[model samples]
Target chain A: MRKDDTPNQDRRHALECMLWGGSGLLWTVAGGVPRSSLLGTPEAHAQSAQGGFSFVHISDTHLGFNMAPNPDPTVTLQESLERAKSFRPAMMLHTGDVTHLSRPGEFDRAAQIINATGIETHYAPGEHDVVEDDGKDFFQRFPQGARTGGFYSFDQAGVHFICLNNVTNLQAGKMGMIGAQQLHFLEQDLSARSASTPIVVFAHIPLWVVHEPWGWGTEDSAQLLRLLARFGSVTVLNGHIHQTMQKVEGHVAFHTGMSTAFPQPAPGSRPSAGPIRDLPPGELRKLLGVNRVTRVQNQAALAVVSSPLEG
Target chain B: MQSRRFLLASAPALLAAIPMAQAQQPATVTIDDHDYAPRELRVAPGTKVVWNNKDDTPHNVVSTDNPRAFRSRILDTDEVFEFTFASPGTYSYYCSLHPHMQGRIVVG
Candidate 1:
């Protein structure tokens, strides 16, 4: 095949896989960007007096990571934290992989840095964090349950937030799995909620299939989505690929948050999935940005704005 | 002045206690070139085993059992993973991504 046609072919194949996978029809992309048909028409900003709840979504801090892929991740994290604080988010949702390794020192340093922000932080475990010791160190620091890993659910601002663990049983080249136990819990967790209630699902890996070949997506996510489909408005947030990508299926919006540490090569940029280094310092910030989610009420629409940290 | 004289007289005993503490330091086993530098490490019980990623690519050091099982996530160069061995036994580990990378830790 011609070199130019490679990306096109890959995109075509990805769409085909999504169709066969049976989640929903692939949303059309205008200019290599997936259109959010599922996202309801953008409504006017609700009256400021109505008071909307907004939260900061940051991922892949990779605190201990120090390399050419943007050396000194701490600076980027500090910048992101400062930006997050400026918005005065009600809370912060860290999608996971907080540290480069599950080292106590790394966790301690990360905890110290994040605690300095004074924002209530919710966490989930990334594949990187649980790979070592099956998440013992992670749970030790950010324990959520008797499971000894970071997986739990909470409610805030009239929305149910379910943090699922997909990185536990990872296999090479395979997407993340939430496992049968968690699946059962999810079924029971939402059993009492009314269908109209807004639901927010957070995970480390993309719950929707992005690219299974490079492990960019999750395996067996359809089962989880099937459970979520019952809700009228569901927003799924994830961070693993270190880049921002979004997909929307009926009543479900799947958004991947960018990493605060470094950016990864686009789906077909390199021969395989790895850190995409060599960007000018200014450009790196643009590639790695933050997404803010705000909700007003049942009738009002949720506004998601992506802002780059670069000045 | 008399208390100061007593402290000076006990300085040798205090110095003697310092070596005992130094002798209890954990023995570190470095993972380099797809192999543990020492191959087998022996240390006192409760000694912490640190696996430093000196390789360019990502590598994992995974244990073989349940409670004792541990795996270092993908580590870039200069990243370090430390686990303290609380029990006296032989702990075996291998790189889940790169099976060729393997080593053993013997804690007494």
Candidate 2:
């Protein structure tokens, strides 16, 4: 049978088994050593159970985008929101590129639709949102500190969530940057937590060195990854490429979410960078959907299940 | 080929009528990479101008000098719009969808 034909629970079980079989062995050497040497106790793991939380991650709504492949993004976004309401996640995190152009109207429309869900929505800016005026409109909507853009972190449950801005003041053909200031903040944020605490990093661009030819990866992300390597469970979520891809290295699992607006050509699929061809009307809804991440317990595994908006 | 011959044949008349016929050939501008392809241009009064939207999203060419002076409806991918310059002065335009996209046209 095809991999996707399996039931959702079976698929989840298979993924869990795979992760455990492949990475579980390495975790004992890499993850277990640090937990024992640094914490020297089971107290850190006990504290994390009290801090468990699950949330929704959505990206690249592109509210004002009205073109082929997916003509009305707002409609699909509403459908996603409706699905999200059913899940009733604690909160929703929008990875970035909320609007196609940083126009006030576009931002307003996106805000209205997101707020209509009645779930608090947090955002990071994408390259398109900051094209005009260095993200003035974006900051006005979602402000950060002296950083002058949206790059902030908050703690929920037991995980330390850090949102980094990597697309500030970018030019064409250049990879995204997180700058030194954000790095300093990251260091300070993780200093208090024991090495065993989970860390969730969200940004608009990929933190890993994915395909750089299309500026899909961040330039200074390796430095950030080195700092995060100490954590026992690190999850990095991004949304610039407009597709679903996952990678695991040591303790960190990097994943990119699909866009509600449109699909982009996979890396190296097209002649040059541009929008991915829109699927047929019937298939469009299947391509654009939402993702859910559930954290069960301190020792229990986390599960990510993606479902289409139409269903 | 036919247009090239027509231009060669009309070269002398075009040169002699440069001042009077200047209004006939307006400037054509291209928008790409979130900025004007040509940041600046020179044109003649009463000339008709065109702005082509080559980017992925929709864009609007709006004049900063006069909010209502001239505005092009939102131009989507592969769409184009033209406007006539009746006054003699430099006019600045930007993507209303993206205010940071700015350009200037000098109409003499």
Number of residue pairs clashing in candidate 2, backbone atoms closer than 3 angstroms, sequence gap of 3 or more or interchain:
3
Q: For residues A1-311, what per-residue lDDT tens digits would candidate 2 score against the true structure?
A: 11232223422111221011110011111221111111212432332233435578899998878877877999999987877776567888898899887788988888888987889877888877776667877777766532646678887766678898887744334578899888998888888877767778999988987777667888888889888977767878898888777676766777788788888778878754456664665767766766665554524333334545643
Q: Give lDDT tens digits, candidate 1, residues A110-157.
A: 888998999998898886676666677778888774363556899997
Query: Comparing to the true complex, what docking class would candidate 2 get?
Result: incorrect
Once model 1 is optimally superposed onto the true structure by TM-score, how far is the C-alpha of residue A170 displaced, in angstroms? 1.3
Interface RMSD for all numbered candidates: 5.9, 7.4
Over 4 Å off, model 1 = A1-51, A145-148, B1-57, B61-75, B78-108
Which candidate comes out best when scored by DockQ?
A: 2
- List clashing residue pairs in candidate 2: A51-A157, A51-A158, A69-A278
Error of 1 at A259 (Å): 0.9
